[model samples]
Target: MLQQRQDVINHLAETPFWSLIKFYMDDEIVATDRKKKSGMDLIKIIQCYDSKQQKFKFGDHEPKAITSEDVVEIFGLNNQGVELPNTDKSTKNMKDSFVKAYFAKQKIGKKNDIVEAYQKLVQDKTPEGAKATASIICVHLLQSLLFATFGTYIAWSFITICGALDQISKYNWAKGVTDYLFKRINKSKKKRKNGEESATINGCIALILYWICLHTNLLETISGRENMIPAIGRWDITKIHKAIRDIRVEEIEISGRIPCVEPNESIGRGIPCSEEPTEEHSNINQEECNDIPYPEQNNESSKKKENKTTGRKRKRTEVRVEEDQSITITEA
Candidate 1:
């Protein structure tokens, strides 16, 4: 069972997605205490993002141009693989097969549903359960973190990759995410320019935020800067100030920090889920839950739970993604 869990989790670490895991494991990755992203001033920075200029105009900071190489470094995604196939838009076969395999085909689940299912399975103490748990996690993260802001129903399209985990490494997921982010940036910028009041520009805000900081000379270095490739692991946020409306730059401290009404929960603690569910949560049939947070990051050699026999196996599906960074699975 332990090996099974390790194998499942390892498949994820092997993907570009692992960069996100490293990003969320805040305290450990930064090797520091109290690194706050709450006052990130994320919106202002993103709104200032000039895709045409390939730059971000942060407050009064010099507008720095971000290169493709910069984006690759920020997200730490592999640009080597073929692009993800356009399945979500291509056909329903992959999602249908996934729905049939993991949950009720008619259930039409959401991100929270995937989380509840994961909590229920991690305790099953079996290889099959571990596999199921990891599969659900891949889909959940692909939606919430990467292709976030996709409407309510689970983006069933990503489930296609769970079986072909090995092939997932072949997809240029980094480029896919970068493209997705740029598309969203353009859309958001265009809307706001047209006088749209909504400040919500989706996609990987954290990734974009870090990408901006990477090209700018604002942050102190991460402890092991020479070795860490991912931007999230290399930038120190604690050395910065909290602000609103406009964020000051170049180490200039504000007269007084802006009063931020924030939750007592640490920003690094993980997503602000509606409620916390423990490992012993016993709601297997429950179809709703708070958005799933990143799985606790652990070493591959970490211990696993006691044995609970594996569950029944269903027919597996193998699929590929399109240029959109996803693929469809047609049973061979």
Candidate 2:
């Protein structure tokens, strides 16, 4: 008898939907106090059994429909197997609605808000897009800064006058800087060759390139020196270069001036200076000579030229009228 009862318990657990149907049928028999019923009553019972069987097989949960409370209990959110309190009535109602909708399609009996609650919990655990992006950038920035600083120091020490200059013969300060930058670049390239993903190294390379462009005056041809500093600090060399180039083009368009060419283009060229006019009435006068032909020249040089040029010349002659109606020209 004990073995038989154990078998029944195991069978009931395996087919919980059928056990529920049997319980409902027994309830109907007891309610009517009838041992036997009509064909229509028997057909209704069979229909219930078939419907429950289909629902149990195709529903989201098998054997028995799992509830939100079950999940909460599993997660240790609720102690002593107690149901959690509904703090937000509207949220509870929304959850209840989703559960009812899901179960109704499967012909399974609804448990209030179970499916909705589970979905909400899953959504709450997901990270926001902006926050994730920021995290990625922060990690990359940290890695890049570490490696680049290391490379910079190595380069600085190796090429300095205090260090072994004989080991790297025919080297200048610029060459030392370039060599340091290339070492970082080649390291990054090797990582890529080895199929390693290193966002930090990439960020470091970008910063190093931007620094090189700024120091070598490559940024000036693309953007004014004033805007270059901010652009380079962003740690994205491509973006910095693009922004500089756009600003330069805009300034050139507004000022009707030619865009500055690369530093290499002006290499070995003389440092430009304005010619002083020999006479006050000379066509190449102070004002004309004071206007720097290269608008991209630094403001200090331009300001000095403007002041010297203006101070070297006298004011224009003023015409004076006499009281006797005769016009008298006087130096004013």
Q: Which parts of model 2 have CA positions greater than 4 angstroms off? A: 1-171, 199-332
lDDT of each: 0.47, 0.24
Among these predicted structures, which one has the highest lDDT?
Answer: 1
TM-score of each: 0.61, 0.19
Best by TM-score: 1
How far in Å is the alpha carbon of 46 misplaced in model 2? Answer: 73
Residue pairs in collision within model 2: 95-113, 96-113
Q: Which residue ranges in model 1 land beyond 4 Å of their true spot?
A: 1-4, 19-27, 30-40, 51-54, 57-68, 86-96, 103-109, 124-128, 150-154, 237-332
